[model samples]
Target chain A: MDAREDRGQQDISGIYRMYSKEVYQYLYHFIGSREAAEDLTQEVFVRVIKSLHRFEERSSMRTWILHIAKHVAIDEYRKKRLQTIFAGTLLKLLPSTEGLPEKELQDKEERTHFEKALLQLKPKYRNVIVLRGIREYTVKETAEILGCTEAKVKVDFHRAMKMVKEVALHIYEKGAGVNEIS
Target chain B: MKFPSDEEVLQEFRNRPDAVPRSEFLHTLERKLVEVEQQHRSRSKMRRTTIRLGLSAAVLLAVFFLAPIFTRLITHPESIMTTKPEAPLVLKGQQLKLAEVSPAVKQTLEKLFNLVPELKTMEPKVIGKEDGVYEIVFYQKEQGKEQRYVSVEMVAATGKISNYENEKAMNEEAPSPTEEEAKQMSAAFLQALLGDEFKQYQVSQNANNDWSSVAYTRYENGLPVFLDRYYVGVNSKGVTYVNTPEGAQPPVSSEAFPKPGTFLSEEEVIAKVASLIELTYSLEKDTGKPLLTYSLETTGYFHAETGEDVESVSSHTSRYSDVISVKPGGKKLAARDADEVAKVMAEEFGIDMNGVSFEADERILPDKKGVEGTLYKSSGGTEKIMVYTNNKELTGFQIRGKIETASSTQHDNKPANAKLTYEEAKEKAVQFLEPYLDSSVKELKIDESQIMMPTSTAYSFSFFALHDGVVVTDQNYLVNVDGQTGQIVNFMDNFMKPIGPFPDLDTAISREEAVKQFLQSHPVELGYILPVEKETLQLRPLPVYSVDTRAYFLLDAISGKLVK
Candidate 1:
């Protein structure tokens, strides 16, 4: 009810309005599961509200928020990996993509292959690809988000792209029947 | 079948169908945010209330006891006259009660009460004499919600209040003062307490604390002494707590201070600093890939009389290596292969290398690049190093431990005699590094050298690993030679292998421009000028600038971007 508290509430609401959608989309592509991404998105905003005062102006507000989102998604991935091992039988009870219509099955399979290849890449490589290639962040912006030198970002992006190309080619060779869109 | 291009693969990945969340997700998230904020505010309020209640109980207990004392003093005014004693009290042998405080201490307490009359109702208690200083504690309740205990230290020698501490429950809802405001408040409070002596102290704002506390150091003439300093802490509730350490006395005279004109010229100092600059590399935090950087750090101060810079502590020799002596376990053995080196190292350092594998054929030391020695590296490239000559003779041994992540370590610089001359130290250093020298090296140039007089006298000599004629910027060998014994105390050869082709230095910016850029980025700040040695008295007052070496960077010659 105090003026300061009221101002803090306003700030949090403003930040949510500006960044909630972008953060949610970033987490969605990162985690590859809509439900998990939504949960992690909520967690990221909670952290953002708590740590907003500590934000430095060295990086843009969007870069800072996405940095927080990246950490939240990574932590969730680690937790889910542990859960998948412990409750493998319970996970099997969840709905399968195989039950979809034949037309939707091909599209689902291709999408699943792309997600699998991304998940298989190392976290460092995946981070560069997601930030620079998928999200289309500039080299300088990617460097700020990754907390590295710009030269290092460029080098990593080059290597990450090469790896992605090799992985996609191998997947196509495996008879997935996917068209060469390029 | 031809593989898809990188661009094609990237486009396919980027164009993948988006995974949209449910429509109600945002509304749910907003509701959750409000709930979380409310819970946080409630917990914070509860914590403040609990502290307030505890403080109020302590103050009430003090008031209950002090009420009777106040009434007794009012009834018999003669009691106050009788309690005052003129004679100086010596507390060397007799057991003194809390009530029987020294007259000097009582005078100090009275003076403080005169300045802040509201504290008189608290009935201050003399705790005891500690380190020739009397401690007094005063308790009081405020607004039925907050209680405060103000403790003051009265020095026996000077009768000056040396320290003050106020313990109270702070109001969490109160707005914290800005850094600039806290600094101004601290300076004003110090001036009010010390009077004319405040002119001798320089206020330095602390960088780390959220409370924005400020520290004041006493400068004699112009030179700030390391001994006398005061710290001021201002809480969110606007309560100021001042702490002045004992042994702080005003300077006797400013006539004998040395003028800045007699010191080294600015150009000479810059040249000396530039000569000490060295290029180094650090691994990127995310990728663990090495990135080039430059460093010019010194743990030294400029000498007052001689005008020469004196290193307080000896420079560390190793770059990525930490050396530890490994015992032979009473067996004299020759280190022929990697296994022999590993065996000797493990036994000496008492390290378990049971499952650890090492390369026996590859004669490369991890710390020293291009140094052909029998090398043994652990799995993570962090642990284990042993050096031997080409003939497989064990010359030097080292154990690389965990990487030091801490920025800097504070080392107390105790003075020592520099027995050996610069020529003698250089000779010892070169002789120590002679085994690692290759035939390609045309000259062993002593690029930088310093004689450090810490607890132990040692000379640090940096030799550029030159090939043909030009200096190999990345390859430099450092050696520390003991002053007394003429022995090599430490050695580090940082010649990274697979050196890339030398870049064209023609397009590089001029040295003058580089200096201009560096000065523009890092403005000089006035720092405390302390004596080079603790035993040396009457240090000349000279204005000195402290450059934060961590913030210093070398601009790329061509791009003008930070190299490190």
Candidate 2:
């Protein structure tokens, strides 16, 4: 232990320990893949590393980190739009098999079914659904995360949940098609 | 461990070790971070960018806006504006008009006005950020500038109201709420607003102002965590404070910040704090032992993680880094007659002293106790200059000019006396002061020296006499050299303040006893403060237990009691 050792700055590890799980979960739902979420979580921390010095204390560490994760989600979404097939292939490579917080969505069937229906949603619908519904952020917070009006977040989340219900009903009618991951 | 850049971090994911089941994600990232840190630390210090000195109108406006007043507004309770709204009717920067708000919001506003009698006379400034979230700001009446009485953000969509701030104590005539009543009332308000989540917060009285002050620090594992603080304002007529800025974390959970519990013991914390201490001279604050002798820079707080001692930012600058690079050249400045001074004053400072005569004033605030000086005053008495010298040679001169600033010398041809660099200005300052350097004074160390304007306008310098390396802080000998002309702009020789009839260090209490008194007087408080990350100059929030630097201002040597 060097007396002048830079442990204070190394508390980035502490920060990562604190916020990484939430960031991973946020990225996981937003991106619709477990492996991609893991990679993007790493990406979020990397961005955190570069921008940590510029982190203003006005906002909490969690809020700032979530803001960064939302940015990563948007960038990933944009790349999925531009780098379509490449991102699509990478997203599909990993199944939602392991390390799922079982307590969040009950049994495996419900979790897979919810995830499956979520994957079917458009970016706009998925954004509102994930932020407002799952994260339980306020309309103002969700609007801030999505960079849109509260009206839009409110309307989108309602419509998105309606669409999810329709999709779930459609899947259950076909005896819950688990093979159709994407 | 240092954090890694994500692009470089991707390869580590590819090379993720399979054997390490306990998660090497942090370890890999830590290694990458340390590698980055090593590379960064090896780099040379960035050059300080020099800005050209220019006294623009914007700078003048800024000075008027930011300059602090002597009588404290909150504490004095006698007063307190973005720009104090003129006449109360002319509200500036009101984004949302009364007509712009919904009918429901109008009803809500009317209800609030009737609920609180103070709201009736106050001017309302409503600013709506979203569809339903409206921030209604109320300003006080015509006696003083428009003081914001309350700023509350209401969420109409979700039957929730957040971000309520009541500055009732700002009103000089506002009633007082005792510390206990304030806590109870504020706690009730917070409980209603946050529902069951308010139970986690521990109430503590903020002892700054005369009025009611309370702060709710979120407790986890029976210890207050960083981030989540629901503060109560000066007075709580309405809800005091419900986290003003939208992004501020609510008193929801302390699952994120677990660093508070890991803080070092008091002895270890004191031990770590010793690292920030350096042998420096400080003018003891009303010390039972006189003679501004040796004092330690024992103001730094301990990093709770371990032994790393981080220096806390104190309001007063340390005299340890004083540079006396410039020696006296004995270039004595001769005393100028009234006409000669008037010409320089008019040309340089834009002051018209056409018919003003220098009147002798025995008792003046400008110079030392017995030094005879002439006061040059214009007809309006707004612009006054005190010249502290006989007709023989110049000792010092103090100027208080009118609103319009000193005219800047900006020439294209580059005159013989162009704006001098910091070093050049120092030399010029020495030339002016060399003649007045009394041989009776002990080592006169330069306490502070800096260029006034970023445009290299003027070089301001202050020298203090030190007794055996310990500086007498109030030895206010000062000199300001004009950066443009390299001429002496302002000079003062007020170092004749009687310091002491020296005391023996042996009679003083032990250093250990002094440290104990310091800790006893100023208890180390647990706080999450943003310390600038030296590796990148970013603010990193660190939770540490440390005494307030303001409170731990001065330590007494003999009585072993810390002085504010």
Candidate 3:
């Protein structure tokens, strides 16, 4: 399609038209932290302007922008960790604020448990699971976004599913313990 | 596509779409990006607009250094545009082959042309070969310089004179000089050195005279011995090189003939050193090439008088990475790779330490170049330190991950007179090591002295203790120290010297004069002058100087100055 389009000249209006809702929704489901997702989504577009030249046209514009967002989030994590260390703290706890609608709190809690489980996976497995199962990007799209071959993505996806099953078992066990206490 | 069993799990998470409030998130990031973008844009704009003007200013400064030299070359008639008819041809095709010429082959032929000064004026004969390199041979002799033909072979890929060999064939070709001829050459040298000291003294070849010739043989005292056949009668304040037959031509560059004393006079050495500093500084300022401050440290190696290789002395500077800058907070930083920094340092500073490596932390800059750092030295169970820079402010250094140094006191062989209060010794050491100090040394501490095993027959060893963070012991001579006086008995530090800052224009003129007299008989001219900016050594806007009359002159400058 319009692969040769000058993404830099397109500006915020073009970004809004093409990616605003999709990126927001992707981030929201991935993090379960509403504030971070919203903040990171905006940051992703800001970076788009700053690193316009690095978009080498090898990947779709959407995939390239998502890659930037991923790196930015990783940098944010590192910055926060360094600050905590400098402040003489042992751990900078992740934000755990629950902001789901009351009606969906149960589903949100399950997702939160899965998110913790996902964190236990290495970054590669976690990214694959999120892209394939959560974001619904196809295996090829996931490979292209990650700069890997489609076959490798499929293998990682299979391993991610197996890890999730293990995570699901742990979640159910924890739920049962809470029920017994109640 | 068939739905996976996990679709329900994914759909549940997607439906809720847990995200922070959109408006607040966008507001914070939008502000930060705008600020960063504005700052970057402004700096880039400034760099583009003002850089050209800065470069022109630098060119004007360089022209100031070159104006006199250029003028001298233009006005000289005998050498004006002297060229053999076939000078400008390229032999790049398959028609070339390689050949080797021996220095012995040329030396045998020197006697035939010794009487004719014009025959010595021929340029090095260039012979191209089938290999990707070319050879040029020339014979150079002046009243006082060494009589040898220097042959250089330059490779094609890097146009560098990869091979340099000297031939001594002149002795074989020309029979040994008759006693009368030797006597005449000796008389000429004696006149240059005699100056106002002794006008009418008789000259004789005396092997016993300390003022005899000193070029070919290494004497028992470690001084070079010139052939003893010619001598100058000296009734003088001090023996000088002018008395020697070859004194008129001294070495072409300082690398060949060194002044005979174990140590240079402080003023003499500093005066020479100051010119080098001026040259490096002006070149950087004019061409915009990276400027470096450099220093050299000498270890006694053997007895200073006996000329032995005893211990190693190293110097360092206060520069770390050229591209890395430590952020004020020390937690975050920006940098380029260490390899890039090393590459530029080698090109700019002439330092190519093997296995050169760096680390960035609160202590080191991560990715920038030209940053300053400290040097560390260790010897005799003690550590010593000095600051260093990559810019060649001084002459020589072997830069590495950390510069290893020892206090002057650690060397057991140092003269006893070198004893100073811990503070006094360090201050003296700094005079030599200061040009090489890296940014790292916050302070210096002197430690205890220990006797070291002697590395040579001339002296016993004593070491001084010192530390910055690393312990280094500097060497001293036990015999040279007066136990009752607690003072160093005999040590010379002329080589460890400091250079002066750039003097006013007239002094610059004198320096130009010295170089001019030095190059008076040589047949090379200033090629096209290119513009450079001082900070980055990057080319800037300006015209290069050159004469339209020569093709090979361009080749020589490219091979010499550019590689240098």
- Per residue, candidate 1 scores C-alpha lDDT tens digits across B157-241 of 4555666765542323456665556666676767666655566566664432343367777654345644357777665555456
Question: lDDT per residue, candidate 3, A23-50, as tens digits?
Answer: 6665554444555666777777767765
For candidate 3, write residues B180-271 as lDDT tens digits: 34444544543343232122232333321122222211111222222111222222221121222211111111122233344433343334
* Model 1 CA lDDT for position A33: 54
Writing each residue's lDDT as its tens digit, candidate 2 over B1-564 gives: 122232212222211111111233434554575465454433311211111123244345545653442112211221010112112221223366655765545655665555466787666877565444666777776586776677666654332355555556444455566444565677666665555455556665442222254677655544454434656553435344455332233212233334455668777766654444433334322332344222445434556776555543321234343534334333334445555555545653455566544533222222222343444322224444655553334456655342212211232112234568766876777665664665545456674422221122455667765555555565546777656766565677654434555555566665555556555545566765434344231234466665444322344565554332
Report per-candidate DockQ: 0.10, 0.01, 0.08
Query: Backbone clashes per model, in order?
Result: 1, 7, 120
Best by TM-score: 2
TM-score: the better of candidates 1 and 2: 2
> Which sequence of candidate numbers ranks them by DockQ, best first?
1, 3, 2
- In model 2, the Cα lDDT at residue B513 comes to 57
Candidates' lDDT values, in order?
Answer: 0.53, 0.50, 0.35
